[model samples]
Target: MDRVCDGIAVITEGKKGSWVCDGMTVRKVVINPVKAVDTTGAGDAYGSGFVAGLIKRPGDIDYALRLASINSASVVQQIGAKHGLILRALPQGKKWMHIKVEKY
Candidate 1:
C-alpha cells in the first residue's frame, strides 16, 4: 500500500492495534485500554478523529493516528455509533491552537 500511496494508515480492531506507512517511515499505534460494548461506527470515529487531528496538529501524522485511535476507542466503548464521540482540542502549547468551528 505504501508503494502506491504517499502514506497509509491501517486501523485494527479487537486489540490488534494499528499501523501507519508513509513512504520512508513506518510506525505502529498501540491501542489504549477501553472496555468494548459495540463495534458499530468505529470507522466513522476514526475518520473524525483523524480529520480533527489533521486540523489541530497539522503535519503530524503520528498525532493524527493517535487521535484516530482515541476516537475509535471511545466509540467502541459505548452502545451506539455516535454515543461516545469526544472531540478534543489541539495541545495547549501548539502554535495554531486557536482553531474554531462554527455550525453551518
Candidate 2:
C-alpha cells in the first residue's frame, strides 16, 4: 500500500475485518458481528460512510473505518440492500456499537 499510493488504502473483509493503510502504518478494524440476510449494498454503504467520515473529521482514519464498518454491517441485516441502511445519525443501542480497531 505504501509503495503504490500516498493516500489512504482500504480493504473490507466483511465479518472477518477490514484493513487500512495510509502509506505508513496499517490498522485492522474488527467489525462487530451481525446476522446478514443480504449483502447487496454493503460495499456502497461502507464507501459512503468512509468518505463521510473523512469529510467530517480530516485525518481521522479510525473514525472513517468505524463508520464504514457500521454502515456496511447495517445493510447486511435486512433482506434488501438499502432497507437496513441508516437515514440519520449513528445508530442507537447495543447492536449498533462502534467498531474495535487495532494498530498493526
Candidate 3:
C-alpha cells in the first residue's frame, strides 16, 4: 500500500520493506529466482520471452499477459523448470486459439 501525500513515490513491498522517493523517475528491477535442479533458467527465460513479445507488438497488454501466463504454466508442468519446454506460434488463420476448459 502507498499514499501519495505531495509528490513522492512511496512503495511498500512487505511489512519490513518500504521506500520513498520522487515519483517522476524510478527504475524497477525484479530479481529472478535460481532453480535448484539446474535443468534450465525457465523463469528468467519466460520473462525475457514475454518482454520480447511486448516489444514486438506494443500496446497489446492482453496478448503479452497471455504469453507470460502460458510460459509460466509450461514451466511448472515438468520436474525441472526448463525441461520439456515447448514454444508454439499462433496459428496464421485463427484469430483466437482454442483452450480446453477444465473443472477443478
Best by TM-score: 2
Alpha-carbon RMSD of each model: 8.7, 1.6, 11.0
Highest-lDDT candidate: 2
- CA lDDT, every model vs. true structure: 0.68, 0.84, 0.42
Question: Given candidate 2, what's the lDDT at residue 99?
Answer: 72
Higher-ranked by TM-score: 1 or 2: 2
**lDDT computed for candidate 3:** 0.42
After the best TM-score superposition of candidate 2, give how far the Cα of residue 14 lies from its true spot, in angstroms.
1.4
What candidate 1 gets wrong by more than 4 Å, as runs, is: 11-14, 88-104
| N/CA/C clash count, model 3 | 0
| lDDT ranking of the models | 2, 1, 3
Give a tens-digit lDDT track for model 2, residues 1-104: 88777789888887898899987789999887889889999999999989998998899888888888888888898887888776668877745445788998
Q: Over 4 Å off in model 3, which ranges?
A: 1-42, 84-104
- For model 3 the local lDDT of residue 42 reads 50
